[model samples]
Target: MNKKSNAVLRLIGILLLTIAFCVLGYLNAKNIKLGLDLNGGVSITYQTVEENPTAEQMSDTVYKLQMKAQSYSTEAQVYQEGKNRINIDIPGATDANEILAELGEPGTLQFADEDGNVLLTGDDVKTATAGMTNQNNNREYVIELHFTEAGATKFAEATKNNVGKRIFIIYNNEVISSPNVKEAITGGQASISPIESYEQAQKIASTIRIGALPVSLTELRSNVIGATLGAEAISTSLQAAAIGIALVMLFMLCVYRIPGLAASLALFMYVGLEMVLMQAFEVTLTLPGIAGIILSIGMAVDANVIIFTRIKEEIGAGNSVEKAIKSGFEKALSAILDGNITTLIAAAVLYIRGSGTVKGFATTLAIGIIISLITALFVTRGLLTAFFALGATNPKLYGIKKETKVINFIGFRRIAYSISSLVIIVGFIFLAMNKKNTGDIFNYDLDFKGGSSTTITFDKDLSMMEIDSEVIPLFTAATGGNASTQAAKVAGTNEVIIKTRTMTTEERTKLYDSLQEKFSISEDKIVTENISGAVSTEMKKDAVWALLIAIFCMLIYIWIRFTDIKFASASVMALSHDVLITVTFYAVLRWAVGSNFIACILTIVGYSINATIVIFDRIRENLHNGSKKKGLEYVVNEAISSTVTRSINTSLTTFISVFVLYIFGVSSIRDFTLPLMVGIVAGAWSSVCIAGPLWFDFVILSKRKKEQLSKK
Candidate 1:
């Protein structure tokens, strides 16, 4: 093909890809799963009646509940809550009572004769599934049952003797079905056929499956969150995201000109591609997941900014636009790769080890990272090349990168170190004070600590703001400000569920009277129950282990890639610094530490490591590229100064995105985004001020030791 033909074909290909992505994204958009926090759903907690349930029993129960909850939504989450409780979260569900009724009682499954002769129990059952079988030239739904070895033998004997007699499948003392034995079956598997529709078959299958739980459970609490609330949350989040992204794109265009415009186009494609991928992979998007997507968008911008800045630098050195583009990408590759890979490491660990909402956050984050890499490395590069082919490749249009004067970062290392130390120390002091004052190091929300959940059906639907400003104050006043409350509106209803610290009878009565007086709600419309923490102690232990593994993995990766233990150590130190500083913010501000806390910390780690890697990449590059002859101080200082603009631009874009989230989001989202914003700023500071200096000191000390060894 001729050059003009190739350019036309490339442009045509880009347009076709864009259109295809949009079509796929739009078509599969409905398949995108929303989590409980996004699409208000039923959150039911069940407590085992047996005291001190074994871990095996808890695991079995959770597994059974997970299977049962999948009937409501495939994205339903069932996990252990605290020690002896199981919590099921079904998103986009409104009817709590209906769900509970369908979930049924955690009772035994038994096979009995019409004469009340007991045959076999659920313990004999290995698995039960619903499927269609051909019968009399028509498809009929059937429940296929597979029994255990012992159960199979017993069932075979019973069927042999009870041929032509009715055998009932009983669950929770209720007869589900009574099928006549046709013939003596020697096989362990049996089919209960000629049932109703597929839905009925599914219901029967679910009932049989529920019998897999080892222990009986009673409802501890059931919360119905309104779908309208979820819709509102999603709408506002999108609005915020659109506004934030527009601002970022505008900033990019104004600063980097043509490259910025190309980046903006790539970013748009990035979002569309991510949505399509999420739908294709059946990834569940929670509120925190949305936060992850927005955060990753910032990272995408960061990558492009790094490359564009390098390109500008090459242009400033009198290189042709094509040469600058090639050189810029080459120079920026290490920083982008190291930064994104470190974040991906954390995300992978989180997905492997984290549970429920944390996993949701990780899924979005991981997907975002992978998609961002595609857009940054390929899509952005292609667009820039296409723009160049279209004759818009003036060096001035790409902006000239002025030479950056080296800043003496190593000399000011002490000030940065002291500032970080002072902040962390003050955070410790705050933790101590908080411990003494509240009997906890940090403020724990309902997810961490068990609480009293009050479900109220109001006369009309109330917004979250009204619930916070109007209803929460009633509880606070009644409890003398000792109660920390969180509320969610039930979808498709005027019901709101409020959770707070365990309430006394007097406090409950007081709350009742206040609700009756203020909202004119009847006692019948209100339900109160004590609920266990959604994030159990065991899960918290798992989170700690996951974080440790993530850090260790990152350390190994950096050491291998950069070929320097000091660089890895300094990066880890900066990561630790960022996390600790964020914790301090949570401690001092007393932000409600809920399930999102783990996600917040993980995000900071990812953000911090990425920032650290950028500076480290520069330092490594400088060290090898003739700057090492000037000594470690000059190399470190020059690296920090050269990459400072990229660091600031990336941080600013990320901060703005999260800041917009805080401004437009609900209280829960605000809590998540606020800490995230703080972490972004903290990560940037640590990367520019902390990580580089720490590495410099390591090198300086190593050099001094080598000199001493030479003298010896």
Candidate 2:
């Protein structure tokens, strides 16, 4: 075949693959499970009656609760919170009261003879299932129970001695059922038949399952999340993402022309494949998870940007277009691998240690990073190659880099260090002042600090936007700080739940009066309760451990890859700088340090390290090519100078994606993206100004130490 014909065939194959994935993604989009925040659901926490529950007890309770919850929805998740708390999240559920009612109070279950002799406890039961039996054209609900070997043997002896006697099933010290034994029952399974209804039988089954828990549980708090916020969030997020993708595509096309077109196509494939993979993996998509996808979109663009920039440099060095393309990819490999691998490590750690939304975010992020790497490395390459073969190989289309002098980033290190230290110091000062004044540093939202949840049945229905603009402000004003609102998801209900910092009785009464005065709500319609933080102490500890482990792993990887501890040390220092600065923004602005805080901080850790590694990779390259003879200062400066464009462009593209999300997203999303924006800028700044200079300082100190040791 001719070159043109082969190119056409490759292009056709690319088009086919893109279409296939896009079609699959579109068809399976609904199959992607949305989180409670996005789908509206019930979030309930149960506290063990025991003050210090054993780990085995907690684990058993969590497992039983998970099985019970899964009966309601397969996507249900039950996880241990603190030592004595178990949290159940059932998405796609409305009416928290109904769910709580059906879930029942978890306590002991016992099967006793009519003489009140205990025969079996819940611990002997393996599982319970509610079913129906047809007899003589009549359907009767039944609760089937399967028992352990010991329970089966015990039941056989009991039934053999007490044939035709009634056996009472007691749950929580209440007689739930009494079934007569017709004969000796030897099998491990038994059924209670002729129940009134399936719901009743199912209730019994659920009770039995929960009763199997080793620890008794009391309801601590229950939240009925409305679908409105999620609907608005999803809609607006999609809009923002679409606009951001279009903007990115336009920017890429305007800058790199043909290669940009190739990248845009690869981006499409990336999204399509991401959706398919997420569905395949059954990864739950939360708001932060969406942020992960969009951020990865930016990162996907970053990989392309890195390669295209290198290709331009190669072409600018007067190489042929085809050779430049190959050389550019080869040269960009290490930075790309190091950056991506570090992020993957973070994601893996988070997935392993984190729970709930944190796990969700980690899963999506890990998948996105993998897919982005593949698309950028393979799909983009194939498209570029086919385009090249089809005769679109003008250097002008890709643009040539002009010769530029090396910037002395090292000379400005002192100023950079001073500025960073000033910002961080001011942040700490503010934190101290806030702690002294309010007894807390960084405004803790309901997700972190626990708060009062007030459910109000208003006279008229209100949309999420209206509630945000009108109702939540009143609550915030009453509470003297931030407040969150959720409309009830139940049909024909005009209820809205408002959450704020824990309030006094007087404050609650005042807020109730305000609501009555404004919306003419009845005093009886308002219900209030104090709820604990959703981000439990255990989760916080897990996040910290995940971050610590991720950083340690990344440091080791960078040390091995660069063959120097200084590069890894310098990179970690730069990461610390970005994190502290971003936290400074949070403290100064008093951004609500909520669940998204963990995601934001971890993201900065991953992002800052990626940028730092890029610079370090360049420095390693320069040193390998014997650029170190000029001096460590020159080597660092030249590396920073050479990669400055890539750093700025990558940061800007990522920033643009997140910026648009902030601009167009709902309040919750804005809360997430704002700090992310700060972190991105901080990451870029530290990578450029901090990492290289810090490495230079490290080398200088090492030499001084060696000289002193030798002299001594």
Query: How much lDDT does each candidate structure score?
Result: 0.84, 0.83
Stretches of candidate 2 above 4 Å error? Answer: 43-87, 93-215, 218-225, 228-230, 459-466, 481-494
TM-score, cand. 2? 0.80
* Candidate 1 residue runs with Cα over 4 Å from true position: 43-87, 93-214, 218-225, 228-230, 457-473, 480-484, 489-495, 521-525, 706-712
Q: Give per-model CA RMSD.
A: 8.2, 9.7
RMSD of 2: 9.7
Per-residue lDDT for 295-319 in model 1, tens only? 7887779889999999999999999
State every prediction's TM-score relative to the real structure: 0.80, 0.80
